[model samples]
Target chain A: MLQQYFGELETGLLSAIRGSDGLVNPRKLYSLEVARLGKRLCSGTSPVAWCGITAPFDLLHSMGVTSSFVEFVGALLAVTGVAGAFIDTADQAGYSSDGCSYHRAVMGAASQGLMPEPAFLVGATNPCSGGLAAIECLARHYSRPLTVLHIPQDESGGNVAYLAQQIRVLAGFVTAHTGLPLDRDRLREAIENTNRTRAAMCEMYALAQRVPSPATSKDLSNFGVVLPLFLGSEAAVELACAYRDEFARRCAASPTTKKRETFRLMWIQNRIQFRQDLEKLLENEYKAVIVVDELNDVTWDEIDPEEPFEGLARRSISIPFNGTMERRVEHLQKLAREYRIDGAVSPCNWGCRQGTGARGLIQAGLEEIGVPVLNLEVDCVDDRKYTEGQVRTRVEAFVEMLHGRSSPWN
Target chain B: MAVPPADFIGFACAYTPLPVIAAAGGAPYRVLPMTESPDQAGRMLHDNICPHVKRILDRAIDRDLPELRGMVFVNSCDAMRRLYDAWRRVDGAAPSVLIDLPPTADESAVAFFAGEIERLARTVESWCGRTIDRSKLSKAVEQHNVLCDRVDALTRRVEAGTLEGGWSRLQAALNLAATTPFDAALKHLDGLLGEAPADRRRASDPPIFLFGNVLPDPDAHALFEACGARIVGEDMCTGSRTFTRIDSDSTEDSCRLLAASLLRRPRCARTFDASDPGRMSQDVLDAVKRSGAKGAICHTVKFCDPYLVRLPLVREALQREGYPLLVLEGDCTLRSMGQHRTRIEAFAEMLR
Candidate 1:
């Protein structure tokens, strides 16, 4: 029943995005392509590989495997308001309530057979422990071949070389399972496509740092899903171009002169993708806007097509969570300074030890640097755990504190 | 606090290279799970991390670490990797290193692990301010080999129903051995060996194989005993898993021998060989068959991802082999033991 609801949601959204012609706007077209991919994943076709976002999708794409991140499915359920039941199912299936909601919801989905059996499964040691653990259970449940990428905590040369070798091994593993060798040209093309998307994302973020902040949080809520899942596709580049152009148009407009662009805030980790009025509440009630987030920026350098495997390996090892806590804190500080942000918020998503575990340190560091941070304890995917009244009160309090020091009213 | 001459290098997982630490003139200390409030660690790490990690960090945060030269962390799980981060943030006295362990033990994995061990050896040598020459490594291997042999021999006696107490006694003894120097561990085991066996055997007490995190207290085993069951064999991180003997004859390359033995040892949930998905479950089954056990118990710590994630599959595999499996979760507390006692006693009754 849950999968059917998602299936209908995808079909409806895809139809609207692809009405008659391709799309009236490129932005809708990108979303339509993404929805199409989501629908296909829900369709439970063979040759699909359920993977973590940190896994090398470029190589999977090169091997002709339909790679879908489990988190994406969890987010979809959250968006469609069907995640509560699945979260309950997972809770009943012995998952700890404190585990990340994203993983639990997907684990629940798998338990109910809402998720299809995959040809294989791939996971990595990055971002957090929850993803790998969830994938291991799913792999075991489905009896699929599981490949786990172990990224070193530190980004030493030896570690990079080690990961690079693993990426080479991953290609062989995928080939052995799928009987399709990764084409060097195909991987290079994927890398080049991803580089284009990264360039466009840079353009969008540059526009976003303006005084009025061109983009809304809702507009970019799906940014996390698109970049990690669709980076190697043409739609990803088109999506970036759409965001860049829309933000540029918004920044160059004339209606912002009379209104107050009161406060600019940065989101840490992932946004509350389920809330319909969250961005509006911040914008209208508090006059604060989430100009950027942790997931919005691309710290990855331009992928070198000449060395596709090494480039992907370098990108994999370079993830902020794969490194020290200081790296992530420093990156947030830089984002704060560069974006001219007043405050920051971390949702401290359940079941995510990597992001939530570093929250106190991050808050302390940001506070030391003259930026007050609110560490909100809320599950990102499961709204059953969300108390909107409490969240609003805390967020309102945080906004008032920011206003007391420097108000947009003045 | 001044560093002790025999500065023990604190390690978390069982798969960490203990023999190498010994080779580099440091005693390898396996941090066991204990029931601690973790108030200090909670101030640093979130309270929701696995209880085992929380307890380990609690010890560090409360300044409960013994005089140590340094710490060695393995990339075994996410919680452990974050433990290293939190340790660095606390600015502890001892320097730390993370050993990047591969998931599989293929040829490439062995080569990578050997290199990692050599790097660890270099780090330890520098810390102790002494060159661990080939002779020192060889001597350490020989000493460690004898300790392993002793542990294996003791474990065999217990499995064969010759020794008297529950497996918890063996677990506690191994815990002491893993945390001390070679000779001290042997002496402690010798003392246990000197105790004459009592005829405590019962045909109705169903023999069972046990596995998972460190069973720090004997209360768990005592509960099993009360439930009319005895652990014929254990695959615990602190039990038989630590007793595998390496090839002491290959003294020319101690690192290679250590890496090989680490692979050859009974596999843990955290250390996946990847060549076979059912290999770990099969090994546990083989151990169960070898010991003539009727059932198995996989006791795990709360939020322990490595063990918890693998439990369902291990349970399924074991059940398919006509072996009843019970998965008991706890935080290594007396209360958790009580909660598990009812379920354990019931399982034993069902087995009977």
Candidate 2:
């Protein structure tokens, strides 16, 4: 069923692109690339790995592995409206409902024999313990080899070397499993691809800071976070370039073509994958556009191909979510200022301790910078407990409150 | 004139090295969650976070805990890390340091963790206005090792079914060691061992091995005893895992030696053995067999992802070994354990 779903989605996306005379938007390209990756994973023609979100996808792609984080599968399940059944399956199997729904959905799917068997598994101990726990469970259930990267919170010289050594060990482990040796040339090329993608993303994000922001809530929803899965491949570069071009065109377009931006907002953490109505309500009803997302910024420097492991290790540890709350808040403060954010909406995603755990600190940090925040205590994946009316009312009231206070930009 | 608060350094996780704090001229105080604290942490943290962390944060928010000179936190898990973050926000005046503990116990990880421990020592030194004397650190390690040896002896008695009162007594001793000064706890242990009674468990009470993240409530253990089950073995943060012995002679540097010893201790679910994904379950099985347990009971706190995620594998291993397994979810309160009374009774009966 997953194979057929991906196959149909891939075909439909291709047909849509072809029908539009190859005038593809970044969102369509990104979706098509993800669909293709999904189809390949289901095809099982190559080595497939279920990894943590912070895993080095570029290196995996360089090794000819079809790898993506487990959360992507969960998001796919949620967006397809079939996550509830999987979640129920997991709950019945004695998995706690209090755990992250994304993991629960994937675990449920794996139990139901809906997921493809991977050759090995890789986990990273950063961002969230829940993610690594779910990955370890999957490794045990599949009876496969697992390599966990112990990402330290502080990115000191010793810490970076430790992580780099582990990444090298991971490369060896992947080789031992898939019988594909790491080619330095291929790895260099992959790093080069990532550098290109990062440059394009920087331009795209900067263009998004325009007065009538060139981006929309749908345009950047989960875009920055999920784009890393394709970092080593040309798909990521193309998708990023398309976004940069689109944003540039929007920024340079005539006044009438640009969308009215009454209030520019920032989205904290992840947006709800299954629901689009909230974005529509914010855009149509309140004239509030989410111009930036928490994960949208280019935080790391360009990876030097000569010392790729060190660069990758530094990038992995430098993610805002991996380190202290002070570091994350500092990053948010910078985003709020650069994006000219009026107010922020933090969807304190249920069961996400890494992101939502620092709810009060994030609120306090933003308010310290005179940016009010609205925290919606709702699950982004599992909508079973979500009350749409309550969320809508909260968002509308937050927007009204923002209107009462003058914008910081003014 | 009012006296200044004692030089107490509060901590929450089992992974915090008490010897370093002791060497730095501070008292190590393990902060356990209390049921009496109000549910106000939801204002700072989400409602779905681990209850252990929430309750700890509640005490900090309500100022229900004792005054401390400093706090130490280990980056053990997401909830624990959040507790550190929330605690710093709630009690901004307390000088605190968070040690970054590596998840894997590899050589590289051990070395990195040793550096983190050294960094922690420097932070604690600044907080206490004293240096961590090497000789003092060795002495502290020796004293901690003595406590561990006594705990292990008591644990062996429980495993042999020769110790009276089973887990409750052992838990009380461990809790005392965790919260009180080392000398005071040592004195209490000495008195308890002097007056220890032989096993008086009934034949109908099945021996069970228990495992979880945190079960600090001694009443919860008494509840298991009331349900007619003898807890012969346990692997909990607040129980056996807290008393890991440090090999002071392993390395010249006290911090490195402490790091190596702590990393080599019996790992919790939060620490993963990547090379052997089944190691945790196998460890539980081996411990259960060593204890001659007829069944196993896993008591994990709700929203504790580290333990909750690995529970099914542990259950599978226990079942494969012909052991009946009972799983209980709680909120670090005796009330939550009380709700599982019937299930525990049924499980004990099934084992019998």
Candidate 3:
């Protein structure tokens, strides 16, 4: 029953994406793909493995484990407009409602038995302790083994070396649990696929820097949301290629939209996933295009397939938000300059300490660089925590502030 | 003959290797959490950060730790890691070093942690301008162990109904022992040992185990006592859990032993032993059983992911053992003392 609901939604979305106009909205296509993937993962035909956002999906793909991420599932529920119910379910189950919406929604799903029982859970220490803690609960609830990646906070070579050792050990753990050893050649191929996807994303990002911004809010937002789930896979590469092709075609056919991108904005962290009309509101109502977001930036050095494990270890530690707040601040300033952003919006997602904890720092840093930032306090997944009107008002006020500035992006 | 202010090194978290700082000829002063809002630090940090961390940052921003030659921060959680970030930005803040404590303490983890401790040792040595001999480290470890044993002995007496200064005083003493220099802390413990025992025990005052994040403030305990309960034991980082014993053999390396002991110590939810899902909770249960407590209170700071996540298992285990458990959320402030008081008193009344 649970599988069919999402499967039917996926089918309907696919039809919507394939309407008579032909490849109308990339957002609908992305949503359709996400729903379809959710259906397949929840069907329980393949061995399911639950992981945090920072968990190495490349290795899991190589090992033939179907990795369903906690945050991705939370975002899926939010987009489907069922995350609030799950949040309430988690609250009833004694989870503090102020906890991260993504974790809480998934916990609610686990309580309702909506989530498929995974063969095992893999948790990493990169993002936040709260997320790891939530995953621990699911592991115990489902009586599944949980393999952990102890990603250190420091940027020292020793820390990378330590994580590399752990990644190797994790491979062994995946092997023991799945009864299949990791094929080195297959892992290398997966890493290569990720590199290809990264190259394509780079092209799309370059296209977004065009004065009018080739991509729409919906297009860039869904692309950012799904990037983490599809990394190191053929599907991810294909999706990236399709996105880049569409972006290039749009730039050539119509250099600018009718509304004119008056304000090029950079969104920090995750978007408000539950508000289905938020992207449209920003574009149609405010003439502000989210030209870039923190998640979309390629912060890590390119992964070396010859030394796959170490490269991945390096990549995980080098993520902008994973290390010191100073690193994230530096990257935000860099993105602001490169994307010609007139302003930035940090959605201070409640309960997400890893993402939202540095809001003040980011704001101060951006302000120092002459870029104003508006901090929007909202839950990324729980719609009940915020109203559309309040968010729209805030965005309007921010855009109004940007209109006063004489930036070239305007 | 007075000790200079620069002789001390301020440190946060119970997992920081205090003996190394002390052995390197520096006083390891504990930086306790403040209940006041950190307006100065607030400018640099988000409002949703842990209050305990906010207070720590506030202190740094206010130059409250002038006596420190430097400071050491443990990468214990997300909040602490960010605390390190904010602490570095404080004007006139002491030079800070972060110790990356691993989540698990398996052989490889211990080996890695030992290297980290050694790295910290070198940092401290540079600050104090003195090289620490292995013998000095051994001696410092010995003093720390003696202090832990003394604290443990007093605790055992209180549990056995032989010694009693009330739970409020005991918690305060533990908090002091946690922060004070080793020699001064030992003197304080000795004085606490000499205090007169209560003449009569209140049979109706239920003994409860208090465990969770740092609850260093004595007022929290006083509230529990006023509600007709005795905090016979604790599993808090700033409480008895810091009184971890080290048993280095004749030939064992002190750094390696310290690493091993820390891995085996009663830790918070942040550290997970893959082999034991209930290790952290069992630590509380063991303390409760030893103290003959009738109930347990797991107080956590809001958004304290480590403690909040392990709560369901702890609650379930305590319930299965026929002991009621109350989980309280605090923000390192007594602002909600009345509400907390009501819940605590009601729980005590239930136990009675």
Candidate 4:
């Protein structure tokens, strides 16, 4: 049922992006679309405001716009005079260790209503604390309450409590504010189906470990099943099920198990998503073990419905992509070892604090674990911010590292 | 105090508490201090949060606040949006309320603020299940006024008592600021006005004013103790910044207080204009003069954008003023002191 919901959503969202004229004040254009979309989504009797948090991936996707702009604009809010704050705990410092600037920019933007009105604001640990704080600030400014959910990287008990609490809070809030109680029976049924979906997700990951695995981001789009389980309606689940099935079909079609001096790796940066040419150079020239990434949806974990309402709240506090820095690095190490993947390519997305700043630390840590990690500084989404050759050369050098050649990449 | 299991609703109303309100009456059971949930408050936003808002999330997710009967939100930044929203949205949550105030000095704004404060007072009265006696509020304010006067006097005492004189006043102020209610603090301050001076005195101490990040532990204080720099003053939220609020007595008095407090905040993400970083620097310099501090130290918390970004600018300003300053950065953990001592010492040296 949920799969069907996400399918419609994804289709609708993608179609909007594809059809838009894409001209207007970027902020206004974006905010108006956000508010309009929010009004539409919220108009429903049962709207689980997907609240798509702008993580490093989204920020690199948007080219460092919103949240960062919020901070400077924050000061401007008190335009008539100098305002006072007991202590400024602004930015993404407390949550994610990656220290991503994009987190702050989006957080600022969201707090100031720069993004679509998320049923509630959301953020993650990688890009850090700015998002959550920004949301909190916004809630205060607008007198609108917030519903938070945290994700845990490791599917341990940590994620359970936060998730449960979120579902419960959201459930009650929807009922109170909109005057519609969640169909308890429907919620329970959703839980059962989500559990099935969860099992399928795990199985898909298992399939990903296969030699010469050809799992695509599209395949693992619902790894944690957050969108489908939490935000996706029945339509979302249907879409996910379809995508998962397609993933299986693709893996079956590509069964070359032996390496021909070419490597398959996961590309994990947002801006990098905009630069597959680098991926092409690595594949076409110096065959490196670079392939699909685990940073996308499915790898992150699902929001369990079986858990009580309080558990959802706990999940909101510690969900994956919602975890702290320690969780992220640890998560990365776990994924690498679990998949027996070779080497990591950590990109420093330009002005993308969360994605890039952690390179220095992640590079050192991953290196110690038999993983040859390269911290490449480049823009992922904006073409103007990076020259193609510069990107190609950097990537080529890293590919050489994967090949065990003593070639300098930096 | 832990909200008993029987009454604890969990999740939805988690951030909202009835403790602080309880304290104002039958012992305020400040509950904001209890839960140590992880913070992803700003993680959803891109790179544009203020340092202060980050602290709130850090506290929410990391620290064990002593919890209040019902905590108050001084609307200082946009980051507070979710903080208040979380309270309102949470189900079975405590009676959540806010003190709305303007940050500017417009007369009409201030008048509106006074009305807001009165309205808030009435709300508090309703939550308390009784009306607040105006006489009591006035008395509390007066008593607090006395405490402020003596604490101000104590600043001079520190200068007279130390080789690197200045510890006595700031220490007293901090302790008094932290534990005492306005009334009790004033009475204590009034009593300590003529307290006997210690015979032991030192004169070579460096009077350093700590700014930026709010030090969660007293290690910074201890370090200052060791380095002979008495912590004269601070604008950090956890410092003198909170205890010193505006004095008002109108319908919008609380609003005026909030506005005054916000305006007095040193340069912060939610305070100073990014284009006008100079406003904060100049304020810090003024704080230094008002506190009679000789040098300045900037402590940058991990991932704290405002302070981290402002340290250089502040340092430049301090240098320009021929005022010694030190920049130290660290995560707000009790166990990380060893890793930070060297940096603190180096900063102390610069101040000295």
Give the top-scoring candidate (lDDT). 2
Q: List model 3 lDDT by residue over A46-71, tens digit each.
A: 77888877777887887888886788
Report each candidate's C-alpha RMSD, comma-separated, in the order given. Answer: 3.4, 2.1, 2.2, 15.9
Candidate 1, A56-77: lDDT as tens digits: 7877776677788888888877
lDDT of 4 at A2: 20
- Which digits, one per residue and each the tens of the lDDT, describe model 3 over residues B1-352? 9854437788878888888988998877778875353466668767777777888888877766546789999988888888888888878888999888878878888988888888999999999999988998988888888988898878766655566556567778887776677778899989878877654366768888888877777777778778887777777777776778876665977788888888767567988876555466676777678868999998887777787767767777777789899988887766655479889989998998
lDDT of 2 by residue, B153-220 (tens): 87777666566666787788888888888778889877767765686657678888898888998788
Scored on chain A only, each candidate's TM-score is: 0.92, 0.98, 0.94, 0.62
Residue B215 displacement in candidate 4 (angstroms): 9.5
Per DockQ, the best of the predicted structures is: 2
**On residues A1-410, what C-alpha lDDT tens digit does candidate 4 reach at each position?**
22333345546655665676642222222223333333343344232232324221111111111121222222222221211110112232122222333333333344334333433333232123343444444443344444433333233433444334444554565456444556755655555555454555566566666656655323332133223322223433443455455446656866553443256565554324332455546555765545445454243345445543543344344333433334556666667666666767666554443444334435545565666776666544333345777767777777766667332212
* Lowest lDDT 10-residue stretch of candidate 3 chain B: B33-42
Candidate with better lDDT, 2 vs 3: 2
| Highest-scoring model, TM-score | 2
Report the CAPRI category for model 4. incorrect
Sorted on lDDT, best first, the list reads 2, 3, 1, 4
Per-model i-RMS? 2.3, 1.2, 1.5, 14.2
DockQ of each: 0.43, 0.76, 0.65, 0.04
Error of 2 at B88 (Å): 1.4
lDDT of 2 by residue, A202-267 (tens): 999989987878898789889878998999998889899999998898888838535557888999
Q: How well is candidate 2 docked (DockQ)?
A: 0.76
- Residue lDDT tens for model 4, B255-277: 34544443544435334331222
The interface RMSD for candidate 3 is: 1.5
